[model samples]
Target chain A: MPQLVTVKVNRPDRRPVRVWVPVLPVALVLFPVVVLVVLAAIVACVVFRIGVVRALGAAWRVISALPGARFDIEQGRTAVLVAIR
Target chain B: MTEQRKDILDMLVAGKITAEEAEQLIAALERDQAPATGSLDARPKGKVKYLRVVVDATDNGEPSRVNVRVPLQLLRAGVRLAALVPPQALVKANASLSDSGVPIDLTQLKPEQLEALVEHLDEVTVEVDSPDATVRVFCE
Candidate 1:
């Protein structure tokens, strides 16, 4: 995947910090998984009479907090702060 | 009254207050008005449409601005997809984050607990103000 985000952090009296966050490989790896999981979650929600969006939302919560999972999280607050100013 | 404050009143009378002094009056006439009601928690809740980041600043004496809108659906999809990354990639990301002084262990991120966070974030607005710039991130 190409670099979707190229953070060019310029700080006075120091070399700039260039961080390239790629998006394509991540998308490639997750597309199939998202398709499968979302479909199953939707089906389960329907069977149990649960709202589909709610069920999907619940699943997202679980997945986002999972160990090794924050692939989609915004950048670290501390990191971004340091980079900005 | 200070010249600025008196000018504010004059501007109001002259019908020019609508341009700038309208809001400036609170600062000029009522210094304590803001602190009396400076409560973020008191802000009303609203449906979230997008994750937005806005920056207004100057670089090298030139004005610069950035406005970015991240669809919530993209975040949802990305979180859902993280579950599929191979263990090797997770290790690499974890090491990289730690080495960069971020102190976050991606390997320990749990998806189950992420829902509560995302829900709360839907109501969050982070505003960063500095001498040279103002930045804000919020869901709206």
Candidate 2:
């Protein structure tokens, strides 16, 4: 069996943020934070659907291209595996 | 037909060699067979423009996945943007996998902020090595 090879091309933007420093007091940073927080929430929700939740989407593409081989996304990277004989 | 010629073309297509190298080779061949032209210095030198990204994965006891290559400029922007985000925000995004070392909720970043970060990216460049073919992001 041909070993599996997974290739992941990082999107121009991939990894998420770690910390959340206000740089200013809550009162001062509230407006920007609110906007950012709202956007972040929307983005986070979309990411689950676009990045994580849609597992079968990538697999379907791989399956259509090569029936004998399988492709899927784990985390966010592309995974390619060979079908058993 | 010659192995040397084949190697040159392969390298050119693979972006391993500059346009000048191919041009030099062609010039050398031409000079070898026929009369030389005007000044060779006048010839255009082609530099490799597009960046390369290579990913190699293996499923052994190690079970390693290596992501090689990132456009230096784009990476710098990513790193800078990564720095702006605090660790708490990452944890909040529920995407922090510290051992993996990549930032959390990155894909969830806002489009405007992301675009702003990348706008200045042209001024910076970086090369990173990662186990999972991800853009580099370090948070303290």
Candidate 3:
């Protein structure tokens, strides 16, 4: 799981902008809500005849893979970058 | 003087090549020997971690670039998630993909097949270069 995410933007005539977000605290605060969502999801899967274990596993995999991703784009004198760590 | 530089100087002294030509040759050689910028290695040193896509283009004299690095784990996770799709949905997706000229069958995708593909991705690199644009896709 990613603990931090950074975003940067630069424009020709404007001051560059940068932001760093710490994810751990947010994740912690959301833990209870996540648990409830998971429970509801499992129940929904059961009612829908979907495999609960597979659904949970797939969700976990997606979340676990969120770290280490980066995207950067630039045009003319403007640029934007996003990084997960 | 390195051996190659000495050779170039000798050639210049002997008039086999003009001073301007020798200068250009030395400059080219120096550039060839210079340390590369950005990542030092062309290929990842160990297990590949990211799938990278880089694009640089100039249109109407305006330059643009895009760089994306996606974790390989995300690809693995996506493959796993694909398996959970209902067969009916996969069939529809396959038909839609084919209609779009992609010619791929989502129904036939398997985790083992993706693993094999990922293993080979470590050794694969794709590049496209033209006057106005350059693109690269590779795993690193």
Interface RMSD of each: 10.8, 13.4, 1.4
Instruction: List each candidate's DockQ score.
Output: 0.05, 0.04, 0.52
TM-scores for the candidates: 0.43, 0.20, 0.70
TM-score of chain A of each: 0.40, 0.24, 0.72
Q: Order of all candidates by DockQ, from best down to worst?
A: 3, 1, 2
Location of the lowest summed lDDT over 10 successive residues in candidate 1 chain A = A76-85
Instruction: In angstroms, give how far residue B29 of model 3 lies from its true place.
Output: 42
**Candidate that beats the other on DockQ, 1 or 3, i.e. the better one:** 3
Cα-based lDDT for every prediction: 0.61, 0.45, 0.88
Q: List runs of model 3 lying over 4 Å from the truth.
A: A31-40, B1-45
Q: Model 3 over residues A1-85: C-alpha lDDT tens digits?
A: 8889999999999999999988888778899998899899888777766798998898889888989999999999999999999
Q: How large is the C-alpha RMSD of every model relative to the true structure?
A: 16.2, 20.4, 12.4
Instruction: Between candidates 1 and 2, name the one with more favorable DockQ.
Output: 1
Please give, for residues B36-126, the per-residue lDDT of candidate 1 as tens digits: 5665656766767567788877666666666666656556656655544445677888889888988777767776556456667787899
Residue B20: error of model 1 in Å? Answer: 62
Docking class of 1: incorrect
* Minimal lDDT window, size 10, model 3 chain B: B35-44
**Candidate 2 on A33-71: residue-level lDDT in tens?**
777865675576465443422333333332233322222
Q: State which candidate has the highest lDDT.
A: 3
Using DockQ, give the best candidate's number: 3
In candidate 2, what are the lDDT values of residues B27-119, reduced to their tens digit?
677676454355464555443222333343344433334323323343333444344444456576565465567656554666466657645
**Share of native interface contacts present in candidate 1:** 0.00
Docking class of 2: incorrect
- Residue-level lDDT tens digits of model 1 in A1-85: 1225456555555675777555556667899997897788677667656667755665656443322211221222212221110
